[model samples]
Target: MIDLLKAKKLIFLLVIVISSFLIITGCGRDSGADIQSAEDNSFIMNTLVQMRAHGENAEIAVEESMDRIREIEYLMSRTLEASEVSQINDNPGEFIEISEETQKVIAESLYFAELSSGKFDPSIGPIVDLWGIGTEEARVPSQAEIEEVLEFVDYNNLEIEDNRARVTKEGVKIDLGGIAKGYAADEVREIVKKHDVPSAFINIGGNVLVVGNNVDGSKWRIGIQDPRRGRGNVMAIVESKDQTIVTSGDYERYFEEDGEHYHHIFDPESGYPARTGLLSVTIITDLSLDADALSTIAYVKGLEAGMKFVEDIADVDAMFITEELDVHLSSGLTGIVEITGPDFNLIEGENFAD
Candidate 1:
């Protein structure tokens, strides 16, 4: 449940996290040098990569990597008839055989669901569909309709065994939109890393995963975008060697009618958007997947509560922007997160407890 006010003010869309280059492992010791390539496809809704020995057979490696990404997209897509997720949605309460790839994602989703106290539930597909904010036909959903949809959003209803998952509840639905891109990014990074590319950065549209710094070994600098623009307007820049900067904002995806604004990211309790005072939450963590989930949770939890929530979590730093554009930070991230642009200000907090 990301804060309703922040969600209303923030609109987000799914973006791919494909890096510009690949990481070359054992670069100087093998048969020729290894080079990495990036590919964008409509099929996976993200980017793909492959690193091969720099020789005549490099094209084959590139093509194979692209195809591997497509295969993953086919198996995990919710819109596809043959996708495991679609099948699960089609036949609830039945065990669905899924690829180990899909299973890993499910496990991570469940882990974050527990960590966020169900605030970052992935079972928000019904509510998402009802609002239709990210689609062409976006509209506000009624209270009764949202309430009915909420009944199907219990993340605990999903049961996983080995490589299969079973949805015990009838109407229970799952949507990986929040965490899918990050997971996909992580997967591609591993794929490229195994191939031994020199250095890389995966920008799944906006969700960025840095495998290594620039080719010269400098820290990768990523600019946090300003939420109130169509272009990718950066608010500030964060430098990291090999880490992720994931942001969840109210301006990423949304629609306006009369004076009301509606978007995705609903609270399970009220079946409406969360009411947290923050406008957006950005997480910086070693793992992009965790950063992605925590951004949603922090956005829903507001300033104080969100700060406390992230404090207990180790090795994770957060930057929170409130509705009025006030910026707050977790202790570890205080001075390191600089505010850039005309609309942001840094403020200190005495205590941020729920």
Candidate 2:
């Protein structure tokens, strides 16, 4: 599991102050609460600050949210020794009986695979292991080797019957690195809401889920990072209320060898880093899991087709940053999204506001 304080520190710079408002969630709350009177309580959990404010019971809410996140890590994390997911990967083809919570996440993952037409597959562990971006042994695997492993990378081979999940393939593994954080963020949001936190931001790594409207009830102005720049340099900002923002990029985790650039996002079919013209894809939605899944799906689908995918999903918006340093906003996100900074050239699509 990630050290909570250290993880929070890495992602804290991503938050930019737009406006202030109290975000409310959880069970107990006074009928009348003042924004100035609300308390901001924070704790380290699942690699980020699980924070919330309830003019009422602030401390307990923060604790509960953090606790839930820790429990989730036990279910979904690969780093944890006793994690159900880790156990499944350790002993492939063995039926791993999972908790109801684990079952639900697996179901959701399968659903996302179907929705994105396998572009957002969860059975990507073969490709992930080959690249080994998070390990010291990261390298560009040969095309022949990648293709050999691709045979075991199909989601249809993942069997979920009743409370048990079995990998039919002999060597395939499952990694939820992209979607689990968003699900955790959503869970934290629900927990705080149950405790009556008026408004808050639960950011697990770079995945952010808004607790409520800002303290003033306007919206949170989230700055989208410039992939080519250092910390705090933003290409654009979006106005959001009770929403989640998730971005997947080549630059997030990657290795360069000779003249070839290899990144974490992989194409299951090709078993190589996706050749998406976009350097990154940022997804905005009410659900963090959806945001996380789509951020990855868009990167795999490339700029043109990915934009259309966002359009197909109702109430979902996205920003695509191409290798050319151009930014493209989904039609539904155009009016509400703003571009800033000097390095990016903003282009409008004919269907930008569709």
Candidate 3:
């Protein structure tokens, strides 16, 4: 009878051990699945701003990041009467007090204008307003009108001191449309970091800034938009981490008239849409602001010069899609870029080194 009792006691302890092991294993699986993902979006900066994050307070972090974007839009938009940009534009000849954000943006704009030799100018506002390419009133402006506004499109006429800015030329206006979204992306990144988010990404109308790697600690795959195809159609893919990707394409903001497509990217010299022999230019860099401004500058520089320009810059990679659907990538992106669409031919940029 004692021997029988010993056997039963051993069985009971074995059962308890098995049950504990199963419970622990089940909790381990649940912990892996508990990594939550949250996403939120808002329409701001004249584009759709999206935020995706993975963490404990991801929802709250996304909400706060979007609020920061809206605040930037309100401060920088030229259409808003009370915006600092409008205030500077409304009083062109006089020094007007502006916010610190406005001052910083203007300062950065001037730097880029000098860097690109005026290829990316903030003083092209008058010309942009005349064409109104993205607005309902978009129409072809006459050559006479173009020439008249061309005089007021010089970036050198603008001056900044402390928190004040002045446009020496009368009727000269400043527009932040080209670089504002990029700045807003940087701001969103800061907020996400403050929330201790391990991984996050912000897409402000295709100006994407990835905060870190994927949840699995892998690189994020970013698609290069096919300029000729519809939205979400990509010609190639770029895998990266903690980078900003900005693309300037003819198809992004354009209007069709008489079978000719006129895009929003204008030449400061011609006061007309740039005919740069390229369909789109994508810039990848550490800062979204640099990527944003460089994409426009490279698009304006055309294919040959654009390729050289990107190669000369440090810590910058670019992908150029030509009119013939040829894909060209900078030296930095030679091995990293993969052509996904069969319609496009890959013309490696390393072959063009001078």
lDDT of 1 by residue, 1-354 (tens): 223564433223222222222122232343333443443333344322322222233344345545665776776667677888888888888999988888988888899888888998877778878887766567776778887888898899888899889788888878877787777667656765666654555555456776654544456666776766543466666777678788888776666777766556677667777777767788899887788788888888877888899888999988888778777778887677656768887788656754
Return the lDDT, model 1, position 46: 35
**TM-score (all chains, Cα) for each model:** 0.82, 0.85, 0.89
Candidate order by decreasing lDDT: 3, 2, 1
Clashes of 2: 23
lDDT of 1 at 89: 82
Task: Find the candidate with the highest TM-score and give its number.
Answer: 3
Question: Which candidate number would show the highest lDDT if scored against the true structure?
Answer: 3
lDDT of 1: 0.69
lDDT of 2: 0.74
Worst 10 residues of 1 by lDDT: 13-22
Candidate 3 per-residue lDDT, tens place, 196-303, comes to 888888888879888777666667778887788656577788877888899999977777788788889999999999998999999999999889899999999998
Candidate 2, residues 168-280, lDDT tens digits: the string is 76787787777888888788778777877776776665677776666556566677777875445677888777888888887766667787778889887788889978888
State how far residue 184 of model 2 sits from its true place (Å): 0.4
Better of 2 and 3 by lDDT: 3
Candidate 1 is scored at a TM of: 0.82
Clashes of each: 28, 23, 0
